[model samples]
Target chain A: MRNIIIPAVLFILVITFVALNLFYITDNASRLDAILVSASDAAKNGDFEEATAEVERFKEEFSAVGKYLFAVIQHNEVDDVIFSSNRLLALCNADTKEQFLSEIEVTRESIKLIRDAEIPYLENIL
Target chain B: MAVAVIRTVILYIIIVFAVRVTGKRQIGQLSPTELVITLMLSELAVLPMEDMQKPLLAGVIPIFVLVIVEFFVSAVVLKSIRLRRILNGRPMPIIENGRINQQNMKKIKLSLDELAEELRILGSYDIETVSEAVMETNGQMSIVLKEDYEPLCKDNMKAKKEERKVPAVVISDGEIQKEGLLKAGIDKEQLKSILQKNGCSSAKEVFYMTSKAKNSYFIVKKEKKQ
Candidate 1:
């Protein structure tokens, strides 16, 4: 039991840090997500200014950060998604799955982000 | 153009987080059950983000739900060893002491051909090269390479009287590596003195540094243009 104390403590501490970091990133992303939803909502309602402001917020937040090869590409990707998404938001009935899929193509775009931001990092780590 | 892009960007963050939290099992190491769950989770996350008509809460809620379920399961697993084994499953020994457990392999529905392929991909050639292979809960095959297959470490790489020591990062970028200083059996003052003699006024001037059994290493940043 005594031999295991420090290892156990350190393990707990390490796990806690990882968990908290995940939580922090999730919380921040979700906050940005709320703004994103509102941006589409505004675009739907013909509120271009509001939609633009929503996107601008994300640009400002991520533009300077995560410049590592992975970060850079993924950040730009989100930039593209939000940019095109604004178009559909402005469409009266264009927010339908067909319109949204055609304009935003969220899944295909997500692969890019995953490939750029997370996959390479994972590959390196492995 | 940007607003729509940012929304997708923001949503990916959550999805990625969920992936990360789901652990490294997503990459090539997944049991059938685990793989299905992973796909289900991804689809669940994507649904809300793509369909604006879907509730705004849809995008974020399932993630929290999964996390809560994980936490609850973890708590139960912690309290009951048997329950832990049941939920998280046990590590089945597929290859025990250089012998394959055919029953275990069949139980997991892994064909011999598939097993051999996976083994070879991970660098194990034969039973001799595989001391053991354990099927992990996440469905990853953990192979402990046999003694001969294991790579030669620095200690073994060197001959007699050429003892090796692990290299340590003494500094990174323009900062004094305080922990590294202590780790290397040196002090800040000594590092600083070395920096000064090297024409660097401060630790900030040093861009990179490393140390080994021999002694120390330092790298100064390029001078700025006047």
Candidate 2:
């Protein structure tokens, strides 16, 4: 009885943990992408002040969940997201409109990749 | 440095617990599936211990998953004979009726030298003396000696012998063992009487003591410090 119960409880816990990780990465990635898109739009409209504030908020948000992300996601993938976000922040601060917009796309793609990898898509599994 | 130390401690505890849960099979006695799990557990634990950047959960989650899977599989395998045979290969006969099964030996990739070495280890210098020898699933050899070559016992000589209980160590290096006292069916008071009878002032004066049956004991006094 104990043998069955222990493994059963652990199986449920592991499944729950994996599900939570998938949901967390997916939700966080979408949130971060939205923030980056907002910043990119602000930069395009010549609103450097709003764009800088939004980029700062994006960094804050990423940092807030960085530890959790690192726990579930691969270190290299998480590191890539961090690197690209920092670059995006620098471009926004320098008021380089075109470069900042392109950097936003790169940052968003990296964040999305992390979430995508968590998903058990056939291509990813293969 | 602190993180590494803490992670090492945690992983040590986890790995020990995992091994304990898996059962008491020695490394050489583990089945193929068990061997794989043991290898995977060590590999998973070492990664986080060496790399502080890798989250401990990265190792822990997979370890738990593997342990759970192994546990569940073993339970299911117990109820299913086919699964058991599939996972842990059936024991093959290497030698039967004093004749070696060369075909089975070849299938298992057991060379003649290896068989000779195994037989030698089993104290069987002559293969013809063995009635049966099985190659177990865990890769150990089990040999049964032929009746003519079997060791002579009291039954063969028609001799009567008294049955005796195995002696349990009651004292070792001046320390009393409670479990040993129980095993020997003696209490502390009886132990004290036995020690007094043996001319020992106390347990500390004794280096080794064993009790067997009622009022039956063996005692060895500690040597004087040089």
Candidate 3:
């Protein structure tokens, strides 16, 4: 009984840890999505100052989770999203509304890629 | 940098767990399939440990999956002799009836020089004296000496044999084993009287005590260390 129970409990603890990691990845990505949307909205209305402030806020939040994200998620995708977000900030500084909106879309796509990569796919199913 | 550290630590812990799942056999003792799995698992774990970019799950998921597959395969092989033979391969008799089995030697891909070297390692320097040499599943060579070359054992000697019993540890470091006393068919009072006769004040004074037979006993006194 002890032998069976010990392994079962360890198995449950391991599953719980993996589930917690998934929950953290999704929650972090969702929170970043919200920030990106707010920044994009400010960018669209030509509110450059407001957009820059939101972008700074986004960078701060991203930095907080950046280390953990790199550890848990695919690095290249996370890197792409981060680079695009940085490019969006640069476009805001240059006051190029057209390029800023384009970079914002790229950043959004990159973020989605990171999230989707973590989701269990057909390749992972096997 | 901290993320890389965390990744390394996690991968180390997980790999340890996976290896533990695969029993405690030494690397050389593992079957061909087990060796392959172990090598692959080590390779899989390295990618995530060194490259923080790779998701921890990227390394962890596959490792756990491999462990599960290996475990399933092992369990299946246990229930089926044919599967076990196919998977782990059977021990091959390289020498039978004082003759080298060339066919089995070729099947095992062992050359004459290697076979002789293995035989020498088993203390059979000359293959001519070996009646049978088998290559065990764990890759160990087991050699059986020819009747003429075999050592004379006790059965070959006409010597008087006496009944012998395993020595029961009655007292260890001041604690008396009641069970050992019971097995020897002696009670606590008898033990105290025996200790009195032996010049030991009590069982506490003795460091080690063993009952060799129904009556024979040995006691080692506890030495004081300054």
Candidate 4:
């Protein structure tokens, strides 16, 4: 009886931790996606200052949750997103609208990949 | 980068503590269940360390869960012999009365040649001379030599010799061990005088010191190069 109960309880705790982490990842992914879209929109409108501000917002969100994402996902995947964000910030600073918009799109795709990776759908799992 | 380094160091300490909680068993002595837990814990701890983007909690929570589960299972197994047997499996007697128990060997899926090889490694080259051999749950063989084949010892030969006490080191690397001194039944004053007689001014001057017998001490002074 104890043998079964011990493992069963541990299994439940494991599931709970994973669920909590999934929700955390989902929340961060949405926030990142929102900021990237806003930054891209600002860049499209030729408002470099507004676009840079949006980039800063994106950076803040990434800094907050990047470490957490690392725990759940691959290092290179997170690093790729970080690298793209840094490039996005630079492009915005240099007033390179075309490059800034492209960087934002790349970063958005990376965030979506990370979010979908955590979804645990059969398609993803298989 | 600094945060990642700090997190790695903290996780390393947590892993050490977790392993300690599992008990002081050698890797080779660990049961199947213990080995699995250790492997999983190692893999889980590396996740946060390898990627700075991962939160420390991601690695920490899973590691703690494993440690807790292992501790609880170990405790439960300790209380119930039946549970221990079920989890680790009971030792099988492979050899009885200098004869190989073929049935028991078949039960554990151990071949006769492998059994002989294990016995040879254990210093029992001649299976005929081994009274019994039990295959422990950890997959090691525990052998009982026949009376006539047993090694000759002082007690067996009834030899008269001085009873030498196991020497305890009171000082090592120029540092005094208070607990070692207490176990050797000596105080600081006696140690000081002994050190002085041995051409040492203080405990710090001595490189090594041991108590072999009552009121007898061996001292080695630290060299200038050291």
Which model scores highest in DockQ?
Answer: 3
Instruction: Tell me the TM-score of model 3.
Output: 0.52
Q: Residue by residue across B52-93, what tens digits does model 1's lDDT show?
A: 335535656776677566656656767998986776689889
Task: Tell me the TM-score of each prediction against the true structure.
Answer: 0.47, 0.63, 0.52, 0.62
Candidate 1 lDDT tens digits, A17-44:
5455445444545555565566556666
**Per-residue lDDT of model 2, residues A1-126, tens digit only:** 578999989867866777777788789889998999899889999998999899889989998888887776567887887888888778877889989888888888888877776676534432
By lDDT, rank the candidates, best first. Answer: 2, 4, 3, 1
What DockQ does each candidate score versus the true complex, computed on alpha carbons?
0.02, 0.03, 0.05, 0.04
Candidate 3 local lDDT, B45-152, one digit each (tens): 998777644677888899999999999999999899999999888999999999999999899899999999998888888999999999998898898999899988
The interface root-mean-square deviations, each candidate in sequence, come to: 14.5, 12.4, 8.9, 12.4
**lDDT tens digits, residues B35-75, model 2?**
99999999999998877557788898999999999999899
Q: Quick one: ranking by DockQ, best first?
A: 3, 4, 2, 1
Model 4 C-alpha RMSD to native: 12.5
DockQ of 3: 0.05
Return the lDDT, model 4, position B199: 88
Summing lDDT over every window of 10 consecutive residues in candidate 4 chain A, give the lowest-scoring window.
A117-126
Q: Candidate 3's C-alpha lDDT?
A: 0.83
